[model samples]
Target: MAASAEKLLNLLLRHGSLSRADLAKAMHLSRPAVSGLVDGLIRQGVLRETGCGASNGGKPPIMLEPVAERFGTIGVDIGHETLLRGVLCDASGKQLAVMELPHGNTFESISEQALKLAASLKAAASIPVAGFGVAVAGQVDHAANEIVYCANFPLKNRGLAERLAAGSGLTVRLDNRARAAAQWEYYFGAADNAEDFIFISAERGIGTAIYLDGKLFSGRAGVAGEIRSLLLPSPDGIGLLPVEQAMSEKFLLELSGNCPDTAGLVTAWRRGEPGAVRTVDYLIGGTVYVTGLLTNLLDPALIVLGGRFRDLGPEFARELATRLKVDPPRQLEFRLSKSGRIGAALGAALGVILENCKSNEP
Candidate 1:
């Protein structure tokens, strides 16, 4: 696969289907070169002819698209304390299947459960599984393919990727759940055209994935977006609290006193209960502060909000917008993630697909 061919594949994936002439024009290559790339991709099972496209005047041109059923990848999102979700997707990042299981207590047990789930999905897949992408709620050593530390879960220093690859017989890529979700957004969601943005995941904890200049910025230690480490001044001037401790779902629930879950808290807030109102205000203020900070630093085009906060809908969006005042030169847009609850899992699968696409390039 030449660089031109890879570019063509990416274009087709983004646009669904395109004619050879379209590919040629997009890549600024000659018609013969585009033809050769298309033929090679078709022969390699990476792409297939998808009927014909409407022509301006002459005969309809043949259109090419990714072979959706020829290659696939699996994604597993390990939660901090609840469920383990998985998704199986094709080369084009279309979901084929999804499953969930309760989180296991130990690393070995969790690994076994995840492997079994992946194996089951693989057994049912029509195409070959390219690899597996695991999204964990923790700091990851991408270079070492290891889970360096997970504050909310018990997976420190675990060769989790190695175990998954060995057990499932497929390549594995492990990453922080927020980073994986950001990748998914960049490649397949509303941020497809965006080169710079912030993906904030506010669930049991607050984590972020930063994209700048069309690349995921992992920083020096792969902990660049770990908001839990942020030590902000307390409102009372008594002490400081980590961002995660101050605004996460778990903390909010604690603040609610009687609310056992997010739903209850939401109800209390709607009812304007004093405790619930105070907690909601605090969370909103914290969120606005972080968004403003990021905006000042990165001047991103978009900010994608994910995790539990996603359910807040328009009210949260409006409040956030009112509070955040960007510089005159920067026009920022904010929206809830369309990836839904399975974003991390879907992102993991898409990461594998993207890596596979790159690997196929010559």
Candidate 2:
């Protein structure tokens, strides 16, 4: 897989299908060069001719697309909650299988469950499994394939990737759930054209991932977006509190009269229940403050609200837009995540495909 060929694959993944002329134009390569690369990819079963494109007064050019049955990758999202989610994706980012299982009660138990989920997805994949990617909620040493620390789980310094690789006999990559989601969104979802944005993962706790220029910004400690400790005015008009406590899933649930889950809270909000209204108003205020703070600091172009935030519905974004007061040089827009709850899992799978593509490049 030469770098040019890799770019060809990426271009196809981005555009769905393209002709040799389109590839050549996008890659800035001659048609002969693009044809040679496409020929190689077709022979390798990585790509295939789909159909003929409409002609501009000449013979219709053949369109090419990734062969969904040629390559596969497994991704597992180990969230802070009790459920572990897994997704099997083909080279083109098309999901083959999706699964969920209960997480273990302890660190070792959770690791084992995650491995189990991976194996199950691998069995379900019709194509060759490239590797496994794990998106966890915490600080991860990506190069080391280890979790440095996680507030909800006792997995600090744990060689999670090593254990998974050993158990499944596959390569493994680890990353923060927020960063994983951000990367996937940038390449495939709402932020496809965005070069600078803030991805806010409002899961069990608020986790943020910052993308600057065109790359994720992991600070010196590889936890630059860890804003849980940032102080904000309490919803009760009392003294300040950690952002994590002020705007956490737990707090939201509590505010919604201890609703069983976010879905129920959304239901209550839709019904215009008093408790849910208070909960939403508090969440809006906190979000406005946080977005303004981040805008003043980094001045990103977009803000993506992911995880449980997606359950907040489209109205949430509308309300947020009205309340947010940021005066950056450029206007900042807020959008809900398009990937929903399975975003981290899908992103983790995309990571495996990307890493395997790089490592196996010829």
Candidates in order, TM-scores: namely 0.91, 0.91
Which residue segments of model 2 deviate by more than 4 Å? 56-59, 219-221, 328-330, 360-362
Query: Which candidate leads in TM-score?
Result: 2
Clashing pairs in 1: none
- For each candidate, what is the lDDT? 0.82, 0.84
- Candidate 2 lands at a TM-score of 0.91
Q: Residues 1-362, candidate 1, lDDT per residue (tens digit)?
A: 45666677777776788999998888888999888888877888888888988989999999888989878899998864677889999988898999887766588778988998898788879888989999988888877988988887778887888888999989999888999988888877857788899999876567799999878999998887666777765645578888888876777888777888877888888899988888777778888888888889888989898887777666777788777887765678888888877899998898787777765642
Clashes in candidate 2: how many? 1
Prediction 2 global C-alpha lDDT: 0.84
